[model samples]
Every structure is written in structure tokens, then in C-alpha cells.
Target chain A: MRIGLLKRHSAVFIVYVILAILILTTGLLSDVFLTFRNLENLLRQVAPLGFVSVGQTFAILTAGIDLSIGSVVSMTSVLTTGMIEGQQQLVLPVLVLVFGLAILIGFINGTIISKTGVHPLIVTLGMMSVVQGGILLYTKAPTGSVPISYDFVAWGNVWKIPFPILLFASVATIAIIFLRLTVFGRYVYATGGNEEVARLSGIKTGRVKTIVYMICSFTAALTGIMLASRMGMGDPLVGERYMLDSIIPVLIGGTRLTGGVGGVAGTIGGIFIFIILSNALNLLDVTAYWQWIVEGLVVIVSVSLYFRQKR
Target chain B: MQVAVSKRLQRSPQHIRSLFERFGIYIFLAILIVTASLVSPNFLKPQNLKDILNQSAALGMVAIGQTFVILIGGGGLDLSVASVMSTVAVIMAHNTEGQNSLFIPVMGVCLLFGIIVGFINGTLITKRKVQPFMATLGMMIIVQGIRFLYTKGMPKGEFPPIQRYLATGDIGSVPTSIISLAVMVIIALFVLRKTTFGRKVYAIGGNVNTARLCGYNIDFTIISVYMISGFMASIAGLYLAGWIGISDNWVGKGYELDSIAAVVMGGTTFEGGRGGVLGTIVGVLIVMMLYNIVLLLGMPVQMQFVVKGVVIILATSFYASFRRTQT
Candidate 1:
């Protein structure tokens, strides 16, 4: 009976095992992989994605997707970096701008999708192109840099823990609380699990969808700001890779693409597993081209395993 | 008197709707043509017209493929089509490097690859019960990786003589690429309108549950449609390779979006069911024409994306409004 229970819960167990394997492999393969500096750097690298995926979790919980998140990240990164442009005093205002734009973009996505009754994919796909174009037109070419002080958010430590990891943890905590304790959180699950029934039960389906989309865009924007600080420059193409990376981790974490389930905790583990694997691969001196192949294979296997377990 | 007035009001709205539905594509095409002509004197010239048609041929072929997948409902998207195209192009170029007689073998391999990829997509979605978006997105990433791995991150080899001839050589006054595009569109039209498989596809899209109850082989039909799409995508890639005289990794970057936009603009609803090849052809022409007009106007390449983005939004909104009024 205990063995059967263990088998049933093996998906979650797999994440821990993978993480342990990654650590052991990396420790054996490269001197740099186990270093505190490298660990800190990895945390900083994964932080922005962690933030974006948290918001993605909310949207996915409602059985929708936000392709526009990557674009939002790019736009915010550009706008914030361009605004701050070595002006130390302008950092706070730039941060505010990022937040405002995130909310506005999120609101628009939510409103248009929920009100028109269009599929989230098409709407978000269109918005992705629109925002990408907006960034391209706005930047003309990638040319802006933030001062070193802004990097404090990305690189600083709070009593030995990296600030970026701290940010990720805080965001994850808030998301968990929201999902567990709030009316909106329950509504998200209900809506995702069965939209028609939720509607029949007096849930404002449109409002719920809108809020979810808004949250996604908002999180993406925040991540964008942090990434800009980390990179110290705005590249129009910077966040393009995040769109797929963010989703892959969520899927790896056992979030059904069909939505209505999964949480931030599993997503965190998924992110850590991915980051460790990637870092280990890099440490082993794998070529970039081969890395892509390996990464893709990992996703395919992980997702197939996830489905197999579900069945 | 009251009945007469009410009937007239209803008839007028219906008239307007029909006009919008039937002539809207033509209107967009005319506007693009006029705008292109106004922007550049070279736009209306035969040479430029030939160039535009040749350029659009590949995109048009892919869009036709996309129309089939979208018509099957289930929010079916095939991002792997572009990657599949690249893979086929690479295989064709590599195997038929110099042998003129090896064209048949190359084409056969490309077709088999398409079938395999499409089968995987279909099986995963239908048998494993994966969402179409997730399945195809995974396939897209996988196919791209395979292509990159096979080529070692750089496209290798060269197109054989016959393949190059098919891409660039003309038949009388018509470009071979254009001819190929026309042939594909015709074949697709025939499949959509006259075949049992095609009818089943529409029925499934219209309502899967009803179609299943009616004893349609849902799995086979869905798989076949995706296979058709994958085959068309490879054909497009082959033509693309021939036309460009070189195959490259980035040959079909973001093409899935372009194909989807063309399909959507062609009046196929993303929700699926009612759409036709006739509209899709016009949609392809309109999109191609827009690109040409943007180029002619000397607008930056970025502007092309902006225009496409706006067109997609407008097209969907128009469709949504039209549906509301119709119901």
C-alpha cells in the first residue's frame, strides 16, 4: 500500500531526484559549479524567469496562456533602462513606470479576451507581435544602459542570501497565499476547472480572466525590470527566449497545459531543475547547438513522463 | 405597414453583411495594389508583379496547409510546419547535392519526414490527449533542434540543378514557383470540397461530439489533415530552397505566425468549422501584397510587422462582430 502511494506521488519525487542528480553531477564535473559565486549567479539568472512563471501560473490556472509576457518583459526592460540611462535618481520613477505599464498591458489583455470571448492564444499571440513591434519601434536599435547601482536589486545579498532568490521566494510565497487563502484564488481554480459551472455559480468569468491576464503581464514587467538591472543594458531581443523557458519549467513542474491545477511550489522546483541542468551542461563544456537539442529532449521526456504518470 | 418596415430593416442589414463578407477581401486587395502603385512606379510593372508572385508562392503554400489544421477546430496550431520545412530543405539539399536523378529520392524522404512528424503530432494530440498547442509547440522545438544538430548549426550542401530549375525557371511567362503554388492551391481546394475525408474534417470541426456520434473515424481524419498540412509545408520549403538557391537555418523563422495570420485573414475562424480555400488564396495574396507595398514605400522592415499586427487584430475583430450580428 505504501509502495503504491509512493508510485502515485512519484512525479513530485522525480523533481527532487533530478535536482539532487544535477547537483551531484555538477559537483563532480566542474570546480566552478559548486562555488558560492556561481550559485549566486545562477539564482540571479533564474530570478526573472521565476517571476514571470509565477504570473504565468495564474493565467495557466485559468486554462489560458500569455505569449505576450516575453514581449512585456522586453518592453519594460527597454523603457526602464532607457529612462534610467545612468541617472541614479530616476530609478524609482522608472520602476513605477514598469509596474504601471505591466498593469495596463495586463488589463488590456484581460479585457479584450474576456469581453470578446476569443481564445486566449490568439489574443495573446496578436498582443505578442504588437508589443514586439512596439519595442522595436521605440528602441530603433538597442542603445541604453543603467548605472551599476541599479544592479543592487539583481546582484545584492540580504544577510548572505542573494536578493534575486529572495525576490523569487517572496513572489512565490505571495502567489501561494493568494491561491490558498483568497476568494480570487479559488475563483481562478473554479473557472479553470469548469468555466461554465463557475459562471452558473455566479462567478464573473470575464472579470476573473481579466485579472489573471493582468497579473501575468504585471509579473512579466517586474521580471523585465530585474533583468534590465542584471544585464545593465536593454536589448530588444533579450526576453525572447524567456517565453518558451518560462512555459517549459511550468510543464516540467507538472502543470497540465490544459490548466486548472499546479502551483508556484512545483514551478520553483521545476525552475531549479532546469537551471541546474543547464548550468551543468554548460559546465561540461557542451556546445550551444548541442545544448539546445538536449534542452528540447529534456522537455519532451519530462512532459511525456508527466502525462504517463497522469494516466 | 409595421411588418413591411421590419422586413426592410432586416433585409438591409443582411445585404450589408453579405457585401462585407463577400467583397471584403477584394476591397483589401484593391487598396493594397493602389497603395503599392502610388508608392513606387515599379510596383505595377510586369517584372515587379512577377517578383511579388514568386515571393508569395512559398508563403501561400504554407498558409493553405495552415487552413486545414485550423479548420479541424481544437485550437489546432502547427508551429512545427516551419521547422519541418527547414528539415526537408536540408535533407533535399544534402542528398541531392549534385545528382539530378536523385530528386525523386530526396522528395520521397521529405514526404516521409512530413508524414512522421505529422503522425507524431496527431497521435500525441489524439491518443495521448495532449493539447494541440502544447504538442505542436514541443514538436516545433524538437524539429528545430534536430535540424540544427544535423547541420551542426550551419546549413550545408547545395540544391541540385533540377531543384533549382523548379524554384527559378519559368514555364512560358509564368514563374515555376507561381505554377507550383497554383497547383498546390488547386489540390487543396479539391481536397476540401470534393473528398469524403474533407467532409469528415468539416464535420469534426463543426462539432466533434456530433461527428463522433455519427460514427466518423475522428482519429484517422484528424491525423490525415495534419499529414496533409505537413506535406504542404515541406513542399513550400523545397520551393523556398530552390528559389533562394540556398538553404539556411533561419529560412522559415516565425513563418508559422505568417501562415496563421493568412489563414485567419482568409476568414477561417480560430474556433474552426466554416472556411474555404478560395478565401485563403486571397488572404495569402493580400498578405504578400502588403509586404510588397511596405517594401515599395521604403518603410523599415519593422513597419511590416506593425502592419501585419494591425491587420490580424482588425481581421479578428471584424470576424467577431460579423458573427455576433449573424447570430
Candidate 2:
């Protein structure tokens, strides 16, 4: 059993080793790379990615991908600011409505996917278009401001640690526990491994699928809230990159694209790797265009690791 | 025997599904055109109608290329088409600088870029065991990065006057764009339906293991499909640039999704094999009509996107359900 556990965890262990090597090299590139200020900024950047990937972890563990999460985050960002409109009183109500809408979108995605047996990519791709269009129709340009009072979500520090890090840590901790110590989580694994077998065993696989989408989108909404707080305004395209970026961390952290294996524990290291690499590249005076090239290579390399690990 | 035949007729679910698969797009097209005409008189005008077809030719080319990739199955697609198109367009405009003489050289350069990008994507997927989605998406970012490096985030120059005229100029009442589209269609149709390579593609899409056991070169077939897709994207980039007549780095931003949507809507299953280019042309028309109607009605671009998304969901679900029944 101990050997089996080690075999299961070996992929994540490899990722952390990469992370350590990357940090050491990047830290040596410049004095500021290891500075407290730089690490705080890095944590803030990783926080939103962390939120989305946690939800992504749920979706992937069930052999599904939510392409619409980026749009969900985009909608949440705009709605959070547009409704709050620089006022404290509206924050609670606005968040309730935003999260409700996010859940509904997820529910719609889940229903079509489960009922029709259509590929999740196509369904969520459509949802992405619809939601993006809705945001544009609402306002083509970026609009809306956040109340300064809501800054705690993204900017506040607790016990000398940045609030974003704390929030991400808390969320990741809860998620890891839920997946590791829950019946529904086991059902997720079973469904991913073989839905026909799981269903034959009397598990409500459809419900599990729907709930995973909901959890995924709910976390996206949370990321949106954090982003809106950080940016101090709503931006329609802010979450545009999350669609692919979220998947990178999940894959890098050792989650299998084919599903039924891996967990969020690995994704934490993946997010850090992504943020640190990006941050380090910037610190090294790499141009944005070149950065994109490097980032592209990173996506392929990390994602391709899954296929190799299976072999 | 008579009783069995009659009983099968009574249980006509498969028959209904096949009918839906065969002519679903035609019905959808007719309805969309009728609705569009009713929405605005301008939609029916010869001039406006010509413009619609002319504009669709640009996107239609890209969609046809995507259909090839989609036909490869296992969720294979070229997400980098948009980036490829934009990069090619930028290269075309910048290199030509309004000179017709440079056209051949520019064409060669643009198509070559497409081939290289496609080769890289194919190699990643087949040789390195990378997922098609991620491989192409990564290639997309890499291409975009390269484009920005060349154009410096700002585009310069324009397509020569001859190219513009060729694009927008019509012969008598017919548009040149339509003629170009016909040539492309014939080429695509011939390659997909007539050639041995085409059959191999179908075999692979139907089942990779079976194809492999039969001694088909999986790597070569998949690589060539991507090559064809990339080559088409280059042609589309040039075609669209002639229409716009201006350089813009962001020209190809949304084509990937829109082209995939159009292809999927045209009765082509995403799982690959079993759909042809003719159906995809109709699907392109349906999407184009939607854009035209939205334009004629003064609807915002956002409305077009929403309608496209809703239609894709509706259309794909219809197909998906029928597919499930057959299985």
C-alpha cells in the first residue's frame, strides 16, 4: 500500500522538483526575484489562477473540461463591479446574484453535456461565446468600479501573509480535503474511470457530473471576485486567458487529461510554477512577445507530461 | 419477411436520425434565410446579398480547412488558424506594400509559414503524444507571439489595388470571391472524396487501432491533414486581407471559434469521419446569413455572437442526441 501510494504520487513529486530548480535558477537571475515584494505580487497573480484550477481539477477529475469558466470569470468580474458600483452595501447582494448566475450557467452546461452526450469542449465553447457576447453587449469597453472596502479579498494581508495567498490556501485546503475524504469525490473518480461501470453500480453519475460543473463555475466566480477586487474595476476581457491558462496548472500539477487520477495537491505546485516562470521571465527582461513563445512551449511541455507519465 | 419489414418501418428512429443528419443543415439554412429576409428588405437586395457571399468566402475557406482537422477525430482541431490567418495577412500586406509584382513571393512566404506551423502542430500531436487541443492552442500563442514580434503590435501598409479589385470586384452580376470559393471547394472535395489519402483519413478517424493494423502511416496522414489546414488558412488570410485592404494584427482573432462552430453546425460530427465539404458549405451559409441578418437589422456584433452560440448549442445537441440513439 505504501509503495502504491508512492507510485501514485510520483508525478507530483517530479513537478515539485522542477519547481525547486526553476525557483533557484530564477532567484539567481536577479536580486529582486527573491524579494518579499516580488513574492507577494507572485502570490496575487497565482491566486486567481489557483481559484480557477481548483474548479478545473474537479472538472478534469471527472473527464470533462469547462471551456466556459473563463467567460464565467469574465461575467463575474463585470457583474461584481457593475452591481457594486463603488458601494459597500451592494457587495453582498451582488455576489449572491453573480454566483447564482454562474451556477445557472454551469447547470446549463452540465445538463446539455449529461443529457446529450456531447463533448464538453463544444458545449462550453458555445457557452463561452454566448457569455462573452453578453458581456460585450452590456458594455463594449471596460466599465464599473469596486468599493475600496472590498479590497480585503485581494489585497489585505493576514498575519503578515498576503490575503490572496491566504484565501487561495484556504480554498485549496478545503478542496483537497473534500476530494480526499468524501463519498461524492469517490463517485467522481469512478465516473471518470468508467461511467458505464459506475452507473451499473448504481451511482448517480449524472448528478455528480452536474455538481462538478457547478463547483467549477463557482470557483471561477470566486476568481472573478478576487480579480474585480484587485483591478478595482471591471474589465470584460480580463479573464480571457483563463480558459487555457487554468488547464496548464492542472496538467502541470499532474492531473491526467483523460481523467480518474490525480488531485489539487499537485495543482498548487503547478500554479506556482506558472506564475514563477512568468514572473521570472519578466524579471529577466524578456519581451512580452517572446514571453508568449516561451509560455506556449511551457503549455505543450507540461500537458504532454501526462501522456508520457501514463506510459 | 414482410412482417419484419413492416415492423422496422414502424420503429423508424434510425430512419429519422439519418434524415436529420443528411438534410438538417438545408432546413436550417432555408429557415434562417427566410427569417433574415423577413427581418429586413435589404437582406434580399442583389447588392447586399452579393456582399454577404463575398464576405463569407473569407471565413468559408478557413472553415473548410478546419473540417479536415476535425475529420481526423479524437477531438483534433486547429485552434491556430486565426493566428495563422492574421500572421499571413500581416506578412502579405507588409511585404507587398501595394506592389503587385511581389504577390508570388508573398504567397509563397505565407503558405510556407502555414506549412511550418502545421508541421510543428502535427509533430507535437503524433510524435510527442500531445493532445491536439493543447498542441494547436500552444502553436496559436506561439504564432501570435511571432506575429507581434514582426509587426510590433502595429500593422503597416495594405494589399495592392489589383488584389482588392480581385476580391471585391464582380464580373457582371457574379462576384469573383464566389469563383475563388468554388475553386477551393472543388479542390477540397476532390482531395477528401476522390483520393486514396482521403479514404485513409476516414479510416483513421473511424478507428485508429484498425487503421494502424491495416498498415496506414498514421503520422503521415495526420501530419498531412494539418498541412492542408494550415495551407488553407494561408489562402484565407490573403483573401480576407484583399477584402479589408488594410493591415491589422488582430484580423484573425475570432475565426478559430467561428470556423469550428460553422463546421460543426454543417452536419459534420466532431468525432471525425462521415461528413463532407458540401454540408460544411451550407453550414457556412447558415452562419453567414445570421451575420448578414444581424448586420441588416443594425444589431451589434455581440448579438451575432450570442445567436451563433445558441445555434451551435441547439444544432450540436440535436446531432448529439441522434448520434447517441444510433450507438
lDDT of 2 by residue, B169-206 (tens): 88887998899998999998998889989898888888
TM-score of each: 0.89, 0.95
Error of 1 at B46 (Å): 4.3
Model 1 achieves a DockQ score of 0.44
In candidate 1, chain A reaches a TM of 0.94
Per-residue lDDT tens digits for candidate 1, residues A1-311, read 99896675576667667778778878987999989888888887788989888888888889888888898899988998888888889988888878888889889888877776656766777788878888898887676889878888888889998998898898899998998799999999898888989999999988999999998998898788888888888878887877767887877776766667676767877888888888888888987767766776677667676677678
For all the candidates, what are their Cα RMSDs to the real structure? 4.4, 3.0
Give candidate 1's TM-score: 0.89
With candidate 1 superimposed using the best TM-score fit, by how many Å does residue A24's alpha carbon deviate from the native?
A: 6.1
Against the true structure, candidate 2 reaches a TM-score of 0.95
